[model samples]
Target: MLTVYAYQKCSTCRDALKWLRDRGIPHEVKAIRETPPTVAELESVLSGTGGDIRKLFNTSGVDYRELGMKDKLPTMDQAAALELLSSNGNLVKRPFVTGDGKTLVGFKESDWAAALG
Candidate 1:
């Protein structure tokens, strides 16, 4: 089954969920804040994004700013960055989807159509 790591209050996550529902795409919704993705799962998802760790972060999130990740991330090693993200869902991009050999960050209707269709 496909899994969507998302925060319930995020509008983008809502839209992504709707997009899947409208298309009759089955998925399991996981509250990112309550249960963040595991390190292995994050690694799998990262592969789909071409190993660009920056894409895995929620750049606009409060935590990202509060923690000064924008400045710190560039200096952090891959392992440290991955560990930080795995421990905090608030730092991850919303509606992170993983399934069918693909992983997606955030919501883009066209992207979903191409990836899932």
Candidate 2:
């Protein structure tokens, strides 16, 4: 089963969950704001993103802007970045899905279909 970390108030997250339900995909949902992904999980997603640590972040989130992540991210190392993400769920992108050796962030219908279908 897939594990999806999502913020309940986020429309994107809701859409992703709906998509999963509509497709009959088996998954468990965790509130991203309450329980961020573990470091290991983040690392797995980072690897899937071709080692682009930035891709794992919710760049457009309020926390990102308030914390100035855009300016600070370029200088942070991978471990530091992952630690921050693991500690703060709001900094993670919505609908973070991982399972079955696949990792995905955000919601792109085609991408999800290709990966989960």
- 1-117 in candidate 1: lDDT tens per residue? 689999988999999999989989989999999898888888998888888899999999999999999899988998898899899999999889887677888899898889998
Clashes of each: 0, 0
Candidate 1 regions with alpha-carbon error over 4 angstroms:
none
What lDDT score belongs to each candidate, Candidate 1 first?
A: 0.90, 0.94
TM-score of each: 0.96, 0.98
Q: Which ten residues in a row have the lowest lDDT in candidate 1?
A: 94-103
Per-residue CA lDDT of model 2 for 1-117, tens digit only, reads 899999888999999999999999999999998999999999999998999999999999899999999999999999999999999999998889988888999999999999999
Q: How much is the lDDT of residue 41 in candidate 1? A: 82
Candidate with maximal TM-score: 2
